[model samples]
Target: MRFKDKVALVTGGKNGMGKAVAMRLLEEGAYVAVGDIDELNIERYLSDFASKKDRFIFVKLDVTNNDSIRKCVGNVIDSFGKIDILINCAGIMGPVKPTWEITENEWDQLMNIHLKGTFLCCKEVISYMIKQSYGKIVNVSSVSAKEGNPNFSAYSAAKAGIIAFTKSLAKEVATKNINVNCISPALIETRFLMEMSEEQKAVLLNKIPMGRVGKTEEVAALIAFLVSDEANFITAQCYDISGGRSVY
Candidate 1:
């Protein structure tokens, strides 16, 4: 129970890696506030953890909107007393199209959710973390950010922005006992993969030296460690969970 008595706020906690992270935290005795845009799905997902009811709460969140993020954070603080950890896991894979074929709206959507959303969440939570004099934050980036995947220009660019954001924020708060870091994953096996074509999938699979896509649970385990007290010395770092695909 590394996180016993701690409070964690997780965006996009309804499904995928976000959901996995939330579950891991709860099992380790943390109070988790799950924020997502899908209320029904969040409710349904929570039902699976009937025994863990007291460990978690659900909030409807739209990460791109400052008002929504503020309200969600407020609700979490009101319920849990303080936010000790933050997992910025809310994201969407925008339409898969060639750079020139992608529309302005699609590009905006990607940036709004992946880049601006992460910034907004971090901005709102850092104040409370700084006040407490201790906190841990994990932003989810992508291998595409470092490797620059073809046909996913918007996602790659936005994820790259996250790495830069995390590094700058980590340095700014290093003396305050706040650890800021990010994970760069490649082609994880999640519902998110449903949107990809066989060709797109092949392109990504070919790059993994381990010869397999990563599992959400494996990434969640990494996150669990990063946010725990065990990682106090780790900050301003971007850990790669890309099945040996990361050159760095």
Candidate 2:
């Protein structure tokens, strides 16, 4: 039980990679607090971990709003008493369009959710972690961050921002025993695929040297290791889980 006696908070925990990470953490003995905007899938979430019900709690979260973020963190600390790890997985695939054709509203919405949301969550939790002098944070970035994917400029920029932010924060808190890192994943097989067109999917799949998209569980395993004590020496690094698409 790598996470025995630890508590973790996962945003976007209702589905996809977030759910996968939550399940993996629970298996290793952590009290998990899940935050997501999708309430419709709560029953499915509960069912998926009925056996570990005592170790999980679901909280409503709208990452774009400050008040909502504060409330969500408060609820987590109230329920679990402490949060030792944080997985910033809340995000959306904004409408696809060329940079020149993308609307101002579209750009703002994407940045607000991905970049600003990550900043807010980290800002809120860093204090608690600082007080304890120990914690691990993993931000879910995308391969698009490094590639600057065409027609998805805003998403790319936002994720790239996450990488830079993670590095900066990691340095500031390294001495406090707070390790901050991020993962840049390529297209993984998940419900997120529903947001992409077939052509878009094909274009991405063609770039993976592995000849297939990655799996959520595979990415979750990497995340599990990053947040566990096994990775205590790691900080400020962006690990590529891009199926050989990234070499640097």
* Model 1 misplaced stretches (Cα beyond 4 Å): none
Instruction: Determine the backbone clash count of candidate 1.
Output: 0
Clashing pairs in 1: none
Model 1 poorest 10 in a row by lDDT: 40-49
**Tens digits of lDDT, candidate 2, 66-106:** 99999999999998899899999999999788889989999
lDDT agreement of model 2 with the native: 0.94
Clashing residue pairs in candidate 2, if any?
none
